[model samples]
Target chain A: MEEESQIPKGRYAADISSINEAHARIKSLILKTPVLSSTSLNAISGRQLYFKCESFQKGGAFKFRGACNAVFSLNDEDASKGVITHSSGNHAAALALAAKLRGIPAYIVIPKNAPTCKIENVKRYGGQVIWSEANMRSREETANKVWQETGAIFIHPYNDGRILSGQGTISLELLEQAPQLDTLVVPISGGGLISGVALAAKSINPAIRILAAEPKGADDAAQFKAAGRIITLPETNTIADGLRAFLGDFTWPVVRDLVDDIITVEDSEIVKAMQLCYEILKIVVEPSGAIGLAAVLSESFQKNPAWKDCKHIGIVVSGGNVDMAVLWDSLNK
Target chain B: MEEESQIPKGRYAADISSINEAHARIKSLILKTPVLSSTSLNAISGRQLYFKCESFQKGGAFKFRGACNAVFSLNDEDASKGVITHSSGNHAAALALAAKLRGIPAYIVIPKNAPTCKIENVKRYGGQVIWSEANMRSREETANKVWQETGAIFIHPYNDGRILSGQGTISLELLEQAPQLDTLVVPISGGGLISGVALAAKSINPAIRILAAEPKGADDAAQFKAAGRIITLPETNTIADGLRAFLGDFTWPVVRDLVDDIITVEDSEIVKAMQLCYEILKIVVEPSGAIGLAAVLSESFQKNPAWKDCKHIGIVVSGGNVDMAVLWDSLNK
Candidate 1:
C-alpha cells in the first residue's frame, strides 16, 4: 500500500482545509459532541481509551455532520432545487434534517422493510418519502426517478468528497480534545468516516496509526485490504446493519493507503461489546458503534505487537440508533 | 418554612463557601458530568429542559461527590481511622471509591438481600463488607458494632453536614453549566442532594424555584411538607430504591425552607420516565434518576399555575445503578 500514491500525486491537498471549513459550517446547525472516558473501561483494556461520543449528535449519529455540510455547501440555484437520498437509517434522517436546516426540501426513498421508527424519523425531519421494494436496484431506480422529476441533487451516503471531508472534522476535534493519541480505532462501512479521519490524522501526524474495525460477517473492506483490490460481497450480513455496505471508489484509495490495519470481529463479539458498552458506559450504542471497542478486545488484536505500544487510543463511537427489539434482546439476555 | 430561621442566623454563615471548597477538594476525584438536552423531550414537556447527567458520575451516581469530600476533608488522625456507612446502593460504592482514592479503609454494612452487583461494586473499590438482616434496626446495629470495633468514623449517607455541603457542589456546577434555569427539579432520598442543591441555588438567587420530586409510594418528604413536621413511614415502597430512605435532620431545615414544592409520582410514571430517558436521551437512567422528569410531567404539576410561567427547567439525574432484573422488567413490560 503506497501512502502518497493513493492521492494520485497529491491532488487532494486541501482535504484538511475543507474539513476545517466543515467544522465551522456545521457548528451552529449540529452538536459538537463530547469526548468521554471510563476508568473501568480503561482498566479492562489496559489502555487509555477516549470515546468521541457522536451518539449525542443530532439525529443520534455523526452522519448529521456530513449531511449538513453537503446540504449547506450547495450554491443558491442548486440549493433551491433541493436534495434527494435513498436510505432507511441515520443518513435519511440526517439528510432530512440538513435539508430542513437549509430551508430546502428532501426526497427520501426507503425500502418497504425499513423500520417504522426510522421512517418516522425521516418524516419528522420533513422528508418526502417514496417507498420501493427491498433491493438496491429498486431503491436506486426510485431515487433516480424522483431526482429526474424534481431535478434535485442526489446526496450519496458516504462516497462524495464533501461528505467524507465533513466526517474528517471528527478527528480534528478529537485530537484537540485529547492530544498525543498514538492510535485511532474507527469502524468501517463504506469507509466514509474512517477514510476522512485517517486522511486528516495522517496529514497532521504521519505516525498516528489509523486502524479500521470491521464485522467478519460483512468484511469486504478487510478482504479488499488483504487482496489489495476492491471486492464486493454477493450477499452482506451482520447485526451491524450500518456496516454492511462495501467501500466506495472515492474512499478506497485513502483507506488502502492510510489505514494501518483492518481487523475483523465475529457478530457474537460485536454483540458482547455492545452489551459491555451499555453496561459500563451506560449509553445505548448500536452494534456498529461498538465495533471499534470489540476490535480492541479481540484476541487477534491483543496478540499483535502494535497493541503493546499503542497507549493512548481514540475510539469513534459512530452512532446510537438501535431498534427497540434488538435492544430489548440485548438487555434481556 | 422560613429560610433564615433554618440556619439559626449564627451558625452555617458561609454555606456556599464550604461548597466551593468541596468543589476544590474533590475536583480531580469526581467528574464534572455533562449537561444534555433533547428536542423530543422539550417538545413533549413544552419547556426548555436541561438534564444534569450525574448518572455518568463515578460509582454510577452523584453520591461520589459527597463521599469524596467527606473522605478527603478528614484530618490525618481521622483519615487513619477510616470511614463507614450502611448502604446497599450507590452511596456504599461511592464511599468505597472515595476511601480508596484517599488511601483509607471503608467498612460497608449491607443487607443479606442486597443485589449481587451492588455488593460487588463495594468490594471492587476495596471496601470491607458485613452482611446483616434486611431491616433498619439490624442495619444500624451492625454498622455501629463495626464502628465500635474499628473506630471508623461514621459518614451518614445524606445527613452529615460535610456530606450535604459536598452535595451542594452539584448546584454550583449545574448553575454554571446551565444558567438562568427558572426551575430546579431534584429527587429526594434522605434529602442530602436536594437540600444541598436548594441551599446553593437559593443563596445565589433567592427567587430561583426549587422543586422536589418523590415517588408516591415513598412520599415521607411530601407528607412532612403537608404536616409542617417530619413523619416517618411505617413501611416504604417504590421502584426507585435509591429514593426510599426517609429525610434526615440536617436536610429537613434546608429543604423545608428553600424548596417551593414537593410533588409525587407513581411508580408506573417513574418507570415510564425511566424508559423515555433510556430511549430518547440514549442514557440508562434508573427510576430514581428519572423522578424529576416524572414530576414535571405529572398531572398535578402540569396543572399548577406556576408551571405555566416556568420556561427553563433543570432536572438532576441522580444515579444509574439499576438492578438488571428490574431493568429487564421495565424494558420487557
Candidate 2:
C-alpha cells in the first residue's frame, strides 16, 4: 500500500497514477478481457461500437479486477484477518474468488432474497455467507457486526479508493486494445465503474468523452447530474437489479465532473439490447450489462446532434451474472 | 479455381497445402476468433481447456470461414455467376454474408420448415431464398433447378474440398493460439468441421489427437467408425439440429482415417453443457456448439482409462444461432 502522504488528493481516492499502480499490481491476477465488436450491430447503431467484455472477467464481472487489487494491496499483517463485504451481486462473488486466490477468508453479507446463482457463486469461491434482510440498513449492519467480530477488513464494493482504482485498469487495457475510441458509453449504478473508467480514459486522452448509461427506473445518476447534487431515490425498480443502487460519495465526484452525460434508458430498450446481445453478439449479458448498448440505441442519443462526433464508441459490458431461470420466466410471460 | 490437374488426388479434395492456401485466402476476410478458457471449467474437467470460440465468428458460426474462402476462391468469370447452396442452416447465412461481401448474389434453397431466425439471417445478408419442400430430395431438386436457370455455381456447405479447406483454417489459428493442446474435441455434423480441423492439426503436429463429438440421436459417425464403413441413418432426431446430417463422401474418408474417436452424448448432457456455457462462460452457444463440451464432460470420456494422457484439450464451440423463442418455449415446458 502507498503511504498516506502519497495518496492522491481528490474528491475520490484514486488518481491516474494509483489506477496505473492498480493495473500493474493486478495484471497477472485478472483476465485481460477481450474487446469484441459486431459488424451488424455497428451498422445498426451507425457507430463503430467496441464492447469491452468484462462479462468474461474472473467471477463473471469486472468486479474481480477491483477485488483482486484490493485483496493484494493489503499488507501481510493487515491481510491475515481476511476481508468482508456486503453484496448480493457480482462484488460478493468477485471478492470471494479474489480472497480465495489470495488464500484469505471472505465474509459475504448477502440478502436472503439474493438470487440462488449468486449464492452458488459465493459458495463456489469459498465465501462464508451471512444472511441479512433484503434491506440496505440490515445488510450494512450485518456486515459491520461481522467485521467487528472477525477483525476482517471491510471492503466496499464501489465506494473505496482502492476498489475504484482497480476498476480503472479496464480503461488502461481498453484504450490499449482500441485507442481510436473517442467516446466510452458505460452503464452506471453505484457509479464506481464509470468513475474508474472516466478517470483513466480522460487521464490518457483528455479529449475522450464519457457517457453514463442508467435505467430510467433507477435513474438516480441522471437525477443527480441534473440537480448538481446527490439525489437518493425513495425506492428503485428495474430488471437490471445490479443498477438499482444510487451513487456512493467516493464515486459521485468523479461521475459528476468527469462524466460528460447521463443517458437514461427504458427497461423495454434494455430488453431489446439484451436480445440483440444474445442474437447478434452471441454473449449472455445481464440487463445492467446491456444498458450501455441500450443507451446508445435509445432515441435520445441517436437524435442528439451534439454527440454526433462519437464515431468510435467503446461500450463496457459490465457483467453477465444473470439468473437464467428468472429471465426465462419473464420472457415466457 | 485451381486446375483439375493441380488438385490433390485423395478421397477428399483438401490437403495440408490446400488448407494452408485456404487460410491465406480467407485470412483477411474472416475473423481471427478468440480462444477463451475458464479457470472454473478447467478445474471441473480436470484438464486445461481452451475453447475455440467460433460462436464469435462471422455469421455466428464457423461456417463463415469456409463460405468466405469458397466465395473468394472462384475465378472472375465463375464468380460473376454468383454462388448457390441448398441449406437452411448456418451455411445459408454464411454463404449469403460471404457473397454480399464479395459483391455477388447468393441463391439459398431453404426448406419451408426452416427456423424463422435463419430465414431472417439470409434476408438480412441479401441472400435470395428459394423455398423448397421440407425434404432433402425436394431441396436438392430445387437447388439443381435454380443452378440451371441462374447459371450460379453450387457451393457445398461441407462436402466441397474448398469448404473443408476453409474450415481447416480454424485448426491453424487454434494451434497457434494454444500449441500445447494435445487433443481437440470437435462437434460433428456433416463431419466438415472435424475433418478440416483434424487434417490441419495433424499436419502441424502428427501426434495431436482428434475426437469427434456427436449427438446420440444422430450417432451415424459413431456407428460408422465402429462398423469401419459408412452407416447412414434412415432418420435422425436430435436437439442438436445442426448435427442431424450424416457424413458426406468428402468428409467421411477424412473422419475415418484422420479422426481418432467419436464420442456420442445425450441431449440432456448437451443441454447441461449449454447451461454451463451461459452461466459460466457467458457465451450463447446453440446445442451443436455445446456438444464439444458435453463430449468432454460425458461419463465415457470421464471414466475411460485408455485416454488418461489427455491433459491440454481444445473444445471447438461450433456456433451460436439458437432461436430464443423456441428455446424459451422448450425450457418453460
Q: Which candidate's lDDT is highest?
A: 2
User: Which lDDT value does model 2 have at A95?
Assistant: 97
* lDDT of residue A268 for candidate 2: 82
Model 1 CAPRI rating: acceptable
Q: By TM-score, how accurate is candidate 2?
A: 0.95
Estimate the TM-score for candidate 1: 0.93
The window of 10 residues in a row where model 1 chain A has the poorest summed lDDT is: A5-14
Clashes in model 1: which pairs? none
TM-scores of all predicted structures: 0.93, 0.95
> In model 2, what is the error at residue A64, expressed in angstroms?
0.9
